[model samples]
Target chain A: MSGRLFHYNTLGTLMKGGFDGAFTFEEVLKNGGIGIGTVDHLDGELVILDHHGYRFDVTGQIHEVHLEDTTPYAAVIDFIPENKTTLNEKINKEILEEKMLGQFSSKNVFQAVKLHGRFSKIKCRSVQKQEKPYPDLVDVARDQAEFTAEDVTGTLVGIYTPALFGTISASGFHLHFISDDHHFGGHVLAFEINEPLITWQTIDTVEQKFPVGDPTFMKTDFDYSSVLEDIAEAE
Target chain B: MSGRLFHYNTLGTLMKGGFDGAFTFEEVLKNGGIGIGTVDHLDGELVILDHHGYRFDVTGQIHEVHLEDTTPYAAVIDFIPENKTTLNEKINKEILEEKMLGQFSSKNVFQAVKLHGRFSKIKCRSVQKQEKPYPDLVDVARDQAEFTAEDVTGTLVGIYTPALFGTISASGFHLHFISDDHHFGGHVLAFEINEPLITWQTIDTVEQKFPVGDPTFMKTDFDYSSVLEDIAEAE
Candidate 1:
């Protein structure tokens, strides 16, 4: 089976304040065709679909990600949808998540999900670029920019991480949105979907790549003691 | 660099009492040349060297692992030593770990280590085969068999996992030993190496595989809340 999820760096390292980006979009795309992440200095939310990367800046403007743009953390999968279903009724995030969980054969395996349709309302948030000596993520998130749109057509690109790997990646659903017109997109906070088409695949293997030689990543003493709590607060 | 580590299943799942093995040695050997793991039912300690798999049963008797033998948890790599050194002086586990850490370019990346030489004294342990209704690792470990030997020649097969991925795998040095004669071996508890040749490589990528359809693995609610503490106490 070609179900493999590729991720660079860890959420714990990002939460610990290591914001320098060493892996470029050029390299990240070679591993998978669809994914989500943040750009250099945590500049904005990143969304990858059809092997192309896009960045939703803090001002809620969408930009085609440059090949050379770097990222501190990201997860991508060469998605091959094993199951497809359509939701005819309006559904919220919590209800959708429960429905998705019910369809999963095992909650322990990672999953790649795609939701394409019109949303009655969707809320997103993106962080601004940071200066050197970056503050921890919880502090950076305090000043994040929030954006809300009504009746927008978009695709929610997401990865479902099991709780056992909460530190490496955000546990549960971590999704990013990119509208059809490519004018608006950011990290998805909450949404109400109407008759959306959902496609998902179980990821049997997770290939985690670390920032081996980056000076900032190497020097940083990553402490994950309160990482789960910090992630809950930050995201 | 072919510095990729392949592992089957998560330590958290094993600790949560999911003990039935679904992946076989035949499947595991295809991923790497050398590694360490446990056989079916958590029956014994397993060590792989030069592409050959061996099992150290609870009775301290070494057996050539059959190709069809299954494993619940294991980590393997196509080892190409990036650096090698000889320790002429006697060194204990703590001192050796310190020396190894100094040579590592990044503590965040996983590492594969091999030590071959004579040991003045070595202590090891292995668990007996468990029956149905498997108990948690902390409870099973209490009945583990301990083995000690003096002035023995052997190879210490080990993997170094970072603290950030502690729940997925055991953090720090997790080593298993096998004598040259293939007579004595088990999970290494403590050892005093004398003039041993040490070789290691940085694992930039870790490919983690899950037991997707296994009934027990699917049903078990893996709780990693106290996993780190439990690992510390069990080991």
Candidate 2:
């Protein structure tokens, strides 16, 4: 009923080490869409908008994503908010999620979420390129590096997928951050809002494209239960 | 490691009525593998083996599936037994699952199960094709036709997926049925097994192929929470 959105693949597949890029950044950014995902090779956190890709790596560095590059997973939609709301109240992540959920009519629809404001303190994390004989995702959480930024001004680009759709997407809000100054950002873990909330929404119509070319994604037969747990622990 | 499993699409997608078959019945049985799924248009239950696809319609009629027929969802792997054990005790479905799960080293991997024996009673259900704009899956659960066979001798073909993979796959066991005489079969709901049980297993290396051509599957954007509940209720 609202505007459109696109999803590339299931979160469960990505969490299971299906990390080869299935689509290019240019392909993902057609029509100037905004979204979040990990870069190919599981290198870092990715935020796409303004016809550019910003990568927040684990080494405390930000890099310009090449247009020719690719991604294994991403959800993007042309930014045309069908609904708008304002909540000028201080809140935490859980509270913010609840507030956004209040605006949704059903649990099955995907909602594109954008919040522009200042945060008290934001904590985020990213993982590096995993070497072969990749350990279980739970085992890799031990190595994830968490970054912190205090009094940060950023636009949290996120999507809210219902918990029942937890396989390829997260059960709830999944936001990736990019600061105003483009200095610090990562996969959002914890954050507190200041005030003057600005929110936007659009429904996503996703097309999941599998990576049949990658032998690993095509051939790996291992269990992802631990990986799911690892993702939960990291979250 | 011994063979491969072909997964047409996610169970989540199937519940959404993306019932157009993606692969042919003969393709699904190239190796004479066994599995469970729904026919195109959600017509009824489908169980394949010995290069023959069996259809169990809602009217309790059994038909031989043409090789050219396709399925929206199915998981099939070459039947190569990696392990075998005798289960010579009378037990209910729950008890049998618990006993077999104990043999697995982990909960994340797929477990293909086969059991041959007499059952005091078996209950199964098959859904008819839904009209569009298709109703929500939860709304249609009230209409599923439940069928029961008493003192039935049949073989149960099943797959056990991890709870973590709950979104696109059943979190636990999903079984389909075929009587010893090839007369009765459908999606298994419940059954009580007699003595001299038979079981088979082989790890499933599954590759999910999304339906890229189905515009509905590619474009639908909505939450599946109620649908998941509907599946639970039906199961």
Candidate 3:
């Protein structure tokens, strides 16, 4: 659940100097559209994921401009366990895995790909109101009959960086996988959720570190190779 | 030589989740060591490459350090062409090619490896520097033709951003490729020459971009794929 997905522009060599052929860092700002798709369990409640659209420099003859493909994270579903693992325990683990992997999401958008159901593809709109707009995932998991939040007390689900959202802890996201099946799938649902990708100057909040002893953490001394390898091996 | 050298500890099985006999991120940081070699051709007189001294964490251990490796950039005597190509132009092209390859140099200080001559196996310093006493590097490439300060424009060799240094620029480097020789079997010499990597926090710099008015400049509003193919074919 708390896992990451790295999406390198596979279609790079076919382009200009590569992925950003004519789209230099400067050009990207002038005319680029980040493509994003989200299936919100809740209607219009914070678009669980939002791609702060792309920019364009000039208009075409018909006044139409093409937006760049900019979706950062894609929901990749691997087979989920079919056995009867306690609902809460399964949910917590799902959240945890997704959060761990979410760290690898684009630095600009602290987005985490959430997984809902033990099935093939996740549909766009099938979640409850209580879980809308960033669910109270931790609190909800506490009510499950077979599991408790204590299972992941010190484990890190996400990291917090102050530079991203001003004084508001913007970047790092933690995973809180919760399980529930009877409501929708009847096949225990898994939620991999985390903080939205916050950008600089866009939000009024300042960056802040996560609470002490969180597993999803980043520090100057922390070596990144091991983490990279861990994620690499999982894939 | 600006190229870096790195090695793995076990060479295998580090990526197997590292949880149950898997290599964990915590272990990698504890043992990783990185060495940076700076070259000389990129330096200018009175233009010191501001190697910010090593920085430490609260525990009083060196968390990060910087160093320099200097080598010559002159072409191998045998490789010097009777043809009209300039040595400077050839060296510049090779260096640019390496950058395009995305070759960044960073080996963990704890798990440090010995520095070798540019791209060759020739070792430079005897004792590998430790990570605890973080230190900055100053490389010097000697015995070459002299040039006036005006002739010594700094090239953007590298860019670095650490929590402490913020954003720093590097220049000191000389990349020269040599053909085989009877005496010292010539391999690629990422040789360091007399130059220094400098910082960007300054005023009155000489760096300039090619203007759009230049006849060589080309602009187009097309897909990146088409443009890239055309450039490659033109070259």
Candidate 4:
């Protein structure tokens, strides 16, 4: 066939989720016209037979097959297998590192803030914890009290909030901030695991309601303008 | 937590070209809160914590877990685990059906054509002898022939092109007729698979090359206006 064939590990995981396991090679071959073969002897390799009688073996991949209608225009998407090496490599770690790095503050910001206690104990939680641990208020206040004379207009209130997920391994320190008394006012902010004072937002609270699942009786005041780009998953 | 998990097995052949496995569960938790107790686990089961924090175990007969990504998001997608299932379920069977169903005749058009003695025996090395036994020529012809009037527009020539696997599965067939005998005729006639008769110019001659590495390049010079809506697969 003149087309391509894609082989995807039926057992492979995906971002969407996992598989239910209701498919087989024999079932795949029920369709007439395409050839069926084995890849790595997996028992269900798809053999696409194009109009030109060329065969492509697609063992584990997703493929697009298009057949045009031209004399001598015989083509098929027999095999469009992808190289596995690229997939195995992790996504750019530097991107995550840079993001985390930007969330931290230099030795200068810490030197500038004055805390109530000289020593404050920090305890991280396990995945199995009941309630998510919150950052200590006294320490947060110190981190939130930074004042930079060099940058004339920046304020310290922009660096503290309740939405921060704490610091993660290899990533920098994480912090969150909310603006003023606007309960749902400014977008929730985040900072790196080790990098304090550098604020970012993972998600923006767009709408709010008194009770969950009561769509009809709800209150929607969160504008979500500040962190729109951060929470834009699709579109 | 409120959403249910469903699983089903293919009894006989369910030949709709694809299957969806949906499972459901009752009110284990409500409104993103924890609920239900620990249940004994088993192999090959999928556990998902819903918005309400109720756990669901989804199991399948033939498929297995491939991958899983969970956020506090609303819905979930379980991709088929095995290569054959993903290929057939997600790619091959689905795309093939879409392409064929979109453009080709709903009812096999070969049934309408009056063929001479034992046209079924007219086998070529281009097609797979094992997959398709002779009698299905009606479906084959229907998938490959263009509609033509009995009037003497020109000569009818049958062209045989091999698919990628040295089979007739993805090949194209066309018939051409010349109004005036000339090496470079401006206007002539041609018919192809799933197409009607049409006049063409010199450049429109059935001599176009396959685009890049496209294996399924059977472009024909017949009228596709009627079936264009039914056969377009870009979506």
Clash count of each predicted structure: 0, 11, 73, 98
Candidate that would win on DockQ: 1
Cα lDDT tens digits, model 4, A97-148, are 3443343222101101101111111111101101113222122223221211
Every candidate's chain B TM-score: 0.96, 0.91, 0.16, 0.15
User: If ranked by TM-score, best first, what sequence of candidates would result?
Assistant: 1, 2, 3, 4
DockQ of 2: 0.09
What's the C-alpha lDDT at position B45 in model 4? 18
Candidate 4, after superposition: displacement of residue A136 in Å? 65
DockQ of each: 0.71, 0.09, 0.03, 0.01
* lDDT on C-alpha atoms for all candidate structures: 0.87, 0.71, 0.20, 0.18
**lDDT, model 3, position B94:** 45
Q: Write the per-residue lDDT of candidate 1 for residues A60-143, one digit (tens) a residue.
A: 888888889899999999899998888778898887888898877667889999988989999999998988888889888899
Which model is ahead, 1 or 2, in terms of TM-score? Answer: 1
Error of 1 at B32 (Å): 2.6
TM-score of 4: 0.15
Worst 10 residues of 4 chain A by lDDT: A110-119
The residue-level lDDT of candidate 4 at B171 comes to: 24
Provide the lowest-lDDT 10-residue window in model 3 chain B: B10-19
